[model samples]
Target: MGEGIPMTNSTDVRQADAAHGREMDPRLFREVMGGFASGIVVVAGMVADEPVGLTCQSFTSLSMDPPLIAFCPALSSVTWRRIRPTGAFCVNVLAAEQRDVSGLFGQRRDDKFEQVPWRRGVSGAPLLDGAAAHIECEIAEIHPGGDHEIVVGRVVALTGDAERMPLLYHRGRYGVLAP
Candidate 1:
């Protein structure tokens, strides 16, 4: 576990900012945010009949009444643009033992799915073979966020294994929850 951040008043924050001669450091902001553990997922889709995906840690369930979920993709992600036009995607919740798959999808490579075995979902998105869970969704809304886009998806299909542990990311490394 990571250490908790000390509570700071607005005045103290302002003083620290003044001392640093900057509003907030991007590196510090990322490091602080990384302290929070997040489940690792691969947001994948078929673009022109080719499998496209990217490792993402910014995934979460937004609503249950309407079956909504969301994930953030970086502004500069090429894979995101490819998947965006597909109108649907699959959120593949990676299993804890699939860190290598996550690392492969995270990179810019011609064949990310060369070794990844997957099948098409009902939404036409690639459903990874060993994912802890799979959420097929149609693109519902997209909102512009700083340095990333908040992509909301309306769940159309879902499947999972309760016994499978999910892969996690925290403080710039991968981890798995204890049973």
Candidate 2:
């Protein structure tokens, strides 16, 4: 006779599977990752004397003692793929006033830097003219992640204007920091 309350060995296995797979639903990964507060960064590099860049939220500080930082670029990102081959990059922390700049970089347009203003950093990577901060680094290591590459960089120079508030990403929208 079937249990009145739906109890069974298969139910027990399903419950156990649910317990083990308690991580956020893979289908909602984008939404879940967006729920995490992250600073906006423009990752830039120069190749063949031309500068290229893209807006990314996957940047993070890795180590303070060794002065290391890292950012992940999706395998499908053409701009990042070019930068990877260049072997150097600059992470530009977007300023609250530079939302347009962020939009330009985040786009799939070919001429992303056409209308945007930028200047060369010490690393020769394009630095947005009014970023809140800029980290110039050399590619120290590249490791394969699921669908992205974890690019570790050795800090060469870290500079910023503290007067500016950072641009932020949350819940699938770009935002400004609260006062």
lDDT by candidate, in order shown: 0.93, 0.87
Cα lDDT tens digits, model 1, 1-179, are 99956645864575489588877766667766898999999999998899999999999999998999999999999999999988999999999999999999999997988889999999989999999999999999999998999999999999999989999999999999988
User: What's the C-alpha lDDT at position 154 in model 1?
Assistant: 99
TM-score of every prediction relative to native: 0.90, 0.85
> How would you encode candidate 2's per-residue C-alpha lDDT over 60-131 as one tens digit per residue?
999998999999999999999888888889999999888888888988877877887888988898888889
Clashing pairs in 1: none
lDDT of 2 at 79: 92
Q: Which candidate has the top score in TM-score? A: 1
User: Candidate 2: where is the Cα deviation over 4 Å?
Assistant: 1-24
Model 1: weakest 10-residue lDDT segment is 6-15
**Candidate 1: where are CA atoms >4 Å away?**
1-4, 7-22
Model 1 backbone overlap count: 0
